[model samples]
Target: MLRSSIYHRPKNNFAYAYDEETLHIRLQAQKGDLQDVTLIHGDPYIWENGEWIYSTSSMKLVGSDDLFDYWQAIIRPPHARLRYGFICNDGKESLTYTERGFFEDVPTHCHYYFAFPFLNKIDVFSPPSWVKDTVWYQIFPERFGNGNPKLNPTNTLSWGETPTQSSFFGGDFEGVINHLDHLIELGINGIYFTPIFKAMTNHKYDTIDYFEIDPHFGDKETFKRLVDECHKRDIKIMLDAVFNHSGYYFEPFQDVIKYGESSKYKDWFHIAKFPLNPGNQLSYRTFSFEPTMPKLNTENKDVQNYLLEVAEYWIREFDIDGWRLDVANEVDHHFWRLFRNRVKAIKPDAYILGEIWHDAMPWLQGDQFDAVMNYRFTNAAIDFFAKKQTTVEQFQNELVHVLQSYPQHVNEVAFNLLGSHDTARILTVCEEDTNRLKLLYLFQLSFTGTPCIYYGDEIGMTGGDDPLCRKCMEWDENKQDLELFHFVQKLISLRQQSPAFSKGEFSFHAINESLVSYRKTLGDEELLIIINPTNRSLKVKFPTSFADSIDLWTNKHVSNDLMLNENEFVIMRKMK
Candidate 1:
């Protein structure tokens, strides 16, 4: 009696039916030194459709010359799907059948065909493209709060010059999970955590170990709880994935430093004869001149495999929503290509963002990342309305270019943010102009792409950069900017009802020295937003066609026509 012999790795004891239309399988199987593996379909391996079928007739091996040796097959079934396996030709064995495994989940309903078998269970997951449309809020873990005092760093010091990077002030992951209501109140749907991986520093970007969460951040359970709670609230989490470099105490780097290149991990880094030569300065073999931040040689296969495993580990262990790849352009594309596949393979709806502040067209050509930070738009808004350094037309042009630079898919995914942890706070950028701040806030919530608001900007928080930008959360009763806060709240409410703010197609109307207007329309919804960037009150009339529009934000009905006073913005909705 020939009992069915099946070999399945990871032994989840279950599999899904594969879609006939999307039969492109990205297998991560190790092959012989021959550089390619063949799948001979149409052989009867497992009992299905009242008979056993083999491999040679099913899939055609793809990318035989490339490093990823993937395969694609198209099999049309008489009904829908069937169980099948491969006649794997690994140059040694001719008809060696891999053990029968569980069913593979198919994405959509396709005509049932004979089931196909492969080495690994085909797991279907792809990151969603709409993730970029989410409004992001970046939280600096340390300054955010101390939900639990026990998690605080051992050494605490006053806020002053020459601050030690390793010292922490008690902000933990639980703090973020607790204050999510505060963020929701501000109309942000996504949160970009600086870094939570285990490390000696408070920031944690210098990763000592990629697999473990920092005990200071409350361990794996806290992070898993945070991810679950956030998802329930319709919010997304973007973790900071620091692959550009590792901290001084990283295991692999430590191995190299201690063993003097004799260790197997020596190939993981680019080494010099005098690897620790301080005189070499910029040319030294560390990450971008930071001696503590040692750069990983991504071109090496071992390094790529290790980092990819780390990426998959998080999505599997913590169920994180997505990742913000820090210094993405600096890392090698070869590594990113493999990295993207591994990430999307786990959570097809996950998002991958790059931290490039300038034009990243070369990297965003559909293969590199889903989107990059929109510093250009943020700067333009700051200059024209906040600093008054440029004319409205210039600002308008900058906004147009931001959209035109990428495809519609990429444009909608771009992170539209102003005043991140790296820049001056929005309040400071606007020079404390309550009116200008209102206008900017109105625009951000109404503009295209995902909007990101730095913490405390709504309450008129002002800071320059670094230490100034990283102030602790101010629960001060006397200093809260209620008026500004309410205005922002109103703008956010308007955005919730306005398609132009969320998914509308945008078009520029007019942009002058002191005025700029744009229109956004999605399906049946239409909106016209006009801004006046001056101090003294200035009245501007809308076109005759939009005369019957109503100001949803202000609740001021425009029966015939409307006017925008100085520094005033009118969000007019087209009446049915």
Candidate 2:
């Protein structure tokens, strides 16, 4: 039987012709219906010195939509060559072509070295539409590791002597930069930094100056270097923006606290009275009870302008990929709407992820944010597998509900994580059971929403709440958990190559309390993941149709009674 292939180019909305080599192409049709499709990749005519020069030597397979339903690849050329396109193998005399798109014209920089590539191109590749369905790793700067002693905090007492809220162990931007290769090996394409802005606390949330880079981490020049270095590796950096509040020493807050109602910043805060006594206990304010961390009066025009300007400065100057808005829901929606519009106007691809734990469908209503942190999914998985709080049915229901609730695009962009700076580490929460943790980890990574791993989760670093969980990076033998670390790396690699794991639609089959099965299918590729979260091993029966597929993790064939040992999972890929 001969397969037939067709070529079609998607409509582009913006100018600045795109390089087809940089774009991701997906072939959509019924499975096994199309004939052999050959994808011919090439560079556009570049305006070098004077005239245009056609650069060739680029070629790639029109990869299977069964493996990858969407065509996505980063277009890169030596230096800043702006012109590129592709030649499709549609069995016709003339090859189908795409207009040359400028790589520099896009808002976000592509991190090819750190990410998995559809094709190995000489030029670094940009992220295609399919890249959104990924697991992100959020790094808390001060807690990650101390790669450079010179960049240590000057005012040690400010953050305190311990590892908790009052403590500041030396963790710097260089530490993050040094570990770029480690992260790449761990399978995290995107890196999220907690707060890099200058602040008085270990957790940069109590932002002292939004404009300046924290001296403890390094100077502004060093921050830029970090961005450049990470970009070269294809890793996107997402910085934390604590816009709803400011530290006590912030200029506006200082003025309000020092001059009472007479101060111009009095309006910037929710002050209740005039002429406040310098010595008197002031009760008037917004947000939490923390006196040092004053909630900004977002209602004020000047206040809003100041914060928005700060955001623009980072995007324009640093070329940061995106911002993770802290305490996002606390601020005004009107301000967020304006803020989002401003950001998109500057960089359409720049993502704005909100930090809201509860049901965040309201924020995802529209332009407010690209996605919110998916805590419900993470929490439910932990409860079912680690804490033994509920049955697999409970976990499966919660997972289905979240996916069905949001629009396809919105759900695709959601940031899902097993652990973060604010909570206990996933491995620690699982009580250091590498096997059980592996089951939970696979669940989160393979599930529908985007998965984000805490910095140390890949290395199997463990700690409890606050200070304990905030322990320094321990590369030494006594502290390292190699088994857990390698497991994470393997899972990450599997995710990148498996189309069903990356871009497939999620559908689950409900079994008894001990077992749950889910399917992720994209065109000809079908992946079935069955998890048994209980202590006893059992033989589970699936519908008769699954009799011919091969288990992905273990290359074993399956039929009616699929056997999964205690705390084991079987990932099968159906082959026709």
Candidate 3:
């Protein structure tokens, strides 16, 4: 029976409150070991005539990785308290699993079951509801466009020039306003700008001032205009907040450098030694050991107030839609809690996205950020679609692990991205193979979570990591890959048109070394997504139930035995 594989816990993703009335319970068993599981649950206090009451609900196999199969069932307790246990059967054998241990037979005692205690409404992980339908477009402001060349830095190079660490091309808010039509054409509903605040570097992570826009980007009026313009076009704007650290030249940090001990603002940062050392030795904590970027002491009351003011100022002044926190993990939880409260108070529906590259359950508990950057999803996609290093089964397993790591609501709104300012562009990652990139986009757009497209990705811009990836947007029609652009646009259109793409239940129905297929079902509307990443053509046979299906991508009717070309993919809508 592989009894050792059976596992459950009372809290976290294993079991959680989906809402005030609904409790989500999850059980883990060895992959393919348990034929089925039934959740034995009820309000722990519900009793009649010297006997406790309970009900049994079947648990569906929600997801599986390399080692474990995750089983889930949604239960609504009338009393908002839950006591639950599992009755697992593996064809011939059956057993009851509980908090204490396993039982040969179903345990009747309430003490043997796991208890949720009570479901508090405040404890529910309620992120902004609008995030599920959002499609984000990430823009590195300096590299996006040059609307006003007059505001260019002294050594600013011409647009489309090869980029270096120090080069700038004066991409201002006006440029973004000028190109709103392009984004509208691509069907982007949200824009995430990487650190538009005033800073020393072209990439403005080192915040010189939180309140003002970078000169290269534009003034506050220009930014406000841009925000209004974006809102007018139904596009939400999310600005990056780099509260984890400030630039070396920041006034408070500079004061510390001037008066090591007596500076009133000395506690604003984590300064270890008296004599300020910028580069030689690590005198103070910095972002990834870069001395120019001094880490902020968020725990201090003064620093917290300062950052919180920054958080509220943007929404109150410019009416920005959200804040994408930079280095959000390094910051303390207390500050994030306060930050969420302050931001939500200003704009309740404002989206808060954290830049977390790994497991972000701690930050995503509804108290802090609504979603994270979803780098785990990005890495898995790159490994399978770009690097070709993982098998389809392995990729699906990795995805299952990610999906099961969070609650259903969190997963729906998670910030899914293929390429960003940090990583190499998607086309470059796929080695300029537009076919492979197309397949990657197909999967991302059809899969769960709110998908994001990096700036210039739709037009097939290709570059390597960091400075290279942050190249100027290719505005020349001759240079842009319009075919790829239309393909991405079509994918976004499909996502918007189909409820199955955004809010459907996701399940991988078929997987192999070369082919990966999944189904998204919401009500009667079903979407079957099939991707072929290999170089050889393959004949994919669909079930007789899918005999009448239409390809959403091409609007053509597909037969049961669909012959997919090399590196081809399709989104088929099942006919009613």
lDDT of each: 0.67, 0.68, 0.89
Q: Each candidate: how many clashes?
A: 39, 25, 0
Question: What would the TM-scores of all predictions be?
Answer: 0.75, 0.75, 0.98
Over the stretch 214-233, how does candidate 2's per-residue lDDT look in tens digits? Answer: 88898888889999998887
| Candidate 2 deviant stretches above 4 angstroms | 1-133, 154-162, 275-282
lDDT of 3: 0.89
Q: What tens digits encode model 3's per-residue C-alpha lDDT throughout 163-197?
A: 99888888888888899999999999999988888
Judged by whole-model lDDT over C-alpha atoms, candidate 1 comes out at 0.67
Who wins the lDDT comparison?
3
Candidate 3 Cα deviation (angstroms), residue 52: 1.2
Rate residue 506 of model 2 by lDDT. Answer: 75
Residue-wise C-alpha lDDT for candidate 1, range 1-576, written one tens digit per residue: 011322222111112222332232222233222223333334233446654443445444322221223334444434333343433444543443333322233212111222344322233222265563577788888777677777766775543223343555777888888788877786777888888888887778789998888888888888889989898888888889999888888898888777864778887877665345435463336656877787888899999999899889988887888889988878988788788889988987778888888988766754567778877878888887788898766676677656644444566667877787777777887787778877887777777777877777878878887667777666564787978877877766666666666767677676344677888788777888777777666556677767767777667776543445688777777844
Best by TM-score: 3
